[model samples]
Target chain A: MPKKIGSKTLLLTSSPSIIGYAAVGAKKEKQGPLADYFDYLSEDSSFGEKTWEKAETLMQKKAIELALQKCSVQKTDVDFLFAGDLLNQCIGSAYASRDMAMPFFGLYGACSTMSESLCLAAMFVDGQLANRCVAATSSHFCSAERQFRFPLEYGGQRTPTSQWTVTGSGACVVAPSKQAPYLRAVTVGTVADLGITDINNMGAAMAPAAAQTLCQFFSDTSTRPEDYDLILTGDLGFVGSRLLERMMQAEGYPMAKLHNDCGLMIYDRVKQDVHAGGSGCGCAASVLCSFILPQIACQRLKNVLFMATGALMSPTSNQQGESIPGIAHLLHISAFPNEKEAK
Target chain B: MTKQEYALWAQQESPKSKGLGDILRAFLFGGLICVIGQLLIFFFENRGAGEMAPVFASACLVVLSAILTGINIYDNIAKYAGAGTLVPITGFANSMVSAAMEFKTEGFILGLGAKMFIIAGPVIVYGVSASVIYGIILFLLG
Candidate 1:
């Protein structure tokens, strides 16, 4: 039987273990706060490829390779590969997975792809569908900018609300082994559109979705801010993070102590000059693999709630002046309560 | 907070507004592009290309922009220089090449060919039509 909790939450009975994680970032991401945490940093944004799109594909491939290497797992051992990216038709994942030679499930949740991939991967393992699977995602600033907003030479001015797309890739190996942190539960949120139309302000557009998912997760689990060691949002940046806090406070949920945004954490806002902060599929993916997962491995962060948010806006939709819809998928990761402790 | 209050708070938390430095940078880079164009024209004209100098110079500028867009240098320039890059013909070339590059993964005929004119298609259509209409008017007037 499926372990479906209230409305959108899923309490995974068979806790899937995150056996290993690998992170790779482009030039700008390498110069950020979590630079040291990344497994590899490419000096060349092209990743030795001529085009940005190809570079993103190489990045996803490299992330999966490195993660598999970390866990000493062979390609044949992995039952399935779950991957996605911000490219058109999710070419990054398809191209990467093609070379990987594994059964693949290509996904597209825009920036929320990390959590989405993880949520689905966890479900597969929890239901005894797979013994091992790899979840990976990538995003390139150049690729996303050209595809979504404006061409590099357009010289179009970016508003203050605009965020820099992060160029990075992150991958993780999920196994049935109890050697690492386990994914306890998942909360998949509904699409939220609060009538936000401005493409320059994705934080404002995605903030509502983050807030709703957080509220639903808390209410379903009957937990408080004290429950989790940290509650991290994917790439909401400064504006969306603060908006989420305010929305939670209105519901009497104090999130000040355990909340952080990966967008804001990636760069130094004033010094780096990343308006708002880093954002993209890679934004949360890189941060999780580079920073959060390592901290959890060391027992520094215990019970954590990670909410990856995505602003589902295509060029056609933006051109049609449709309101941007946001979606957030959350997962609960715990490093403690080891096999010994549980026994 | 109420909806209005939340909106106001979010706005307040936005990044720093554009400063005078941004305008100055944009102006400098924009002027630099024009200067490059002028220099190319001068070089070509001095080489005995005469009236064809301006044409070669513009073609060269567009080619340069397209290449830079490929190497990803034009984006950094646009980031700091802002709209200065877009005002020139080089910007249009960048759009075409970038669209082609982005959609190439979809397939050659459908992806690259279809999206190739996403930004420039309208301009070419209107440009040709307008020139033809002007020519007709001139002929009638004459």
Candidate 2:
């Protein structure tokens, strides 16, 4: 059973292992640095689908299938599926899981959905309520752009702080089996709004939430930043990343050397012309499943802290002049299931 | 730190626009677009377009904008061009065409037809209303 470590962190004693994982990306992602890590890459941003929304769904479905296939696990073996995306009503996850015929829990944590879903899945497995579960999330550039910002072909300039929404999907299968990379603990974050109202600067909006979560996790675990091999943030990109580092420094947890952001890792900012960096649910999701997990599995990385941050505001909220609230969910992953060894 | 303090710090920490460089690009590209319009007006006038030269040139620009938008090149140009592309007749046409193309998947009536003017709708409403106000003021002054 999962034990409450402190006020915010949940220590999963059972230590659910992510036995299978896969990442699927579109054209822009294919051109990025982590292209080779992705399980599947589609040149067409639409994934050969007529609509961008449908393409997002298809990309998510492919990721789920690839994950299951890699682990030699059948769909029937999975007890539950937790998924979400950036689309309205989480249609991306819903349509993706439609044909799966598994019990589905649709979540909405914005870009932080990958870790949010993973935390829930791990909790369910740790409690022995389910033998196995799948956590998945997806986001597409065109679909998000039309719904949140503007029409795809609209002639408008993106600001320096604006981030490109990544067209990608990532999935992971969590089970009680003893795997190399284990889910050790999870810190569910509270919403932190620093009163940032600029819709173009999501990184700034989400950075406060990430700092809050990381500080809380460190306090709860009685561990410092040096304890982990890497402290990975979801989609804070360049602006948010710098803000987070400064915040962490102020909080006396200077982790400049150990910290990295999925948004920054996914794309080459200079070459890709993606001003600030990449920002999407898929940005962290794909990076975790494809790049981070494999390194952990190979024993290259021993202890890691993965936290995905999200801006919990809709177009309506932003348009209504409401400040963007941000949330971040943290997962402490280790190469071994043994608690003492991890510590 | 307090929320107010953090907000101020974050705002300062975030990157700012390129300032003068961006302004220069906007000026150059915007001027280039106007030069193209002037050239088209000249060509139409040479063909005896007379007072219709400006209208024909505008139509040509709109059509060219629509084509660029269809081929998915206008956005890339606009990214560097900034206000250069946005503050023009071509930008207005691109707005309508892009919205129509995007919402087409939702269907014609509710999607393409209705939302075709989603971006340009507000501009049209205020533009026409202001014109009516200006006409009334002109009549009173005369």
The candidate that wins on DockQ is 2
Candidate 2 docking DockQ: 0.83
lDDT measured at residue B83 in model 1 versus the true structure, 0 to 100: 65
Interface RMSD for candidate number 1?
3.1
Which residue pairs in model 1 clash with each other?
A155-B82
Candidate 1 residues lying further than 4 Å off, grouped into runs, are A337-343, B1-9, B19-78, B88-142
CAPRI category for model 1: acceptable
Q: Rate the local accuracy (lDDT) of all candidates.
A: 0.86, 0.94
Residue A130, model 1: lDDT of 90
Candidate 2 has a TM-score of: 0.98
Best by lDDT: 2
Q: What is the lDDT of residue A211 in candidate 1?
A: 85
Interface RMSD, candidates in the order listed:
3.1, 1.1
Model 2 clash tally, residue pairs? 0
How many clashing residue pairs are found in candidate 1? 1
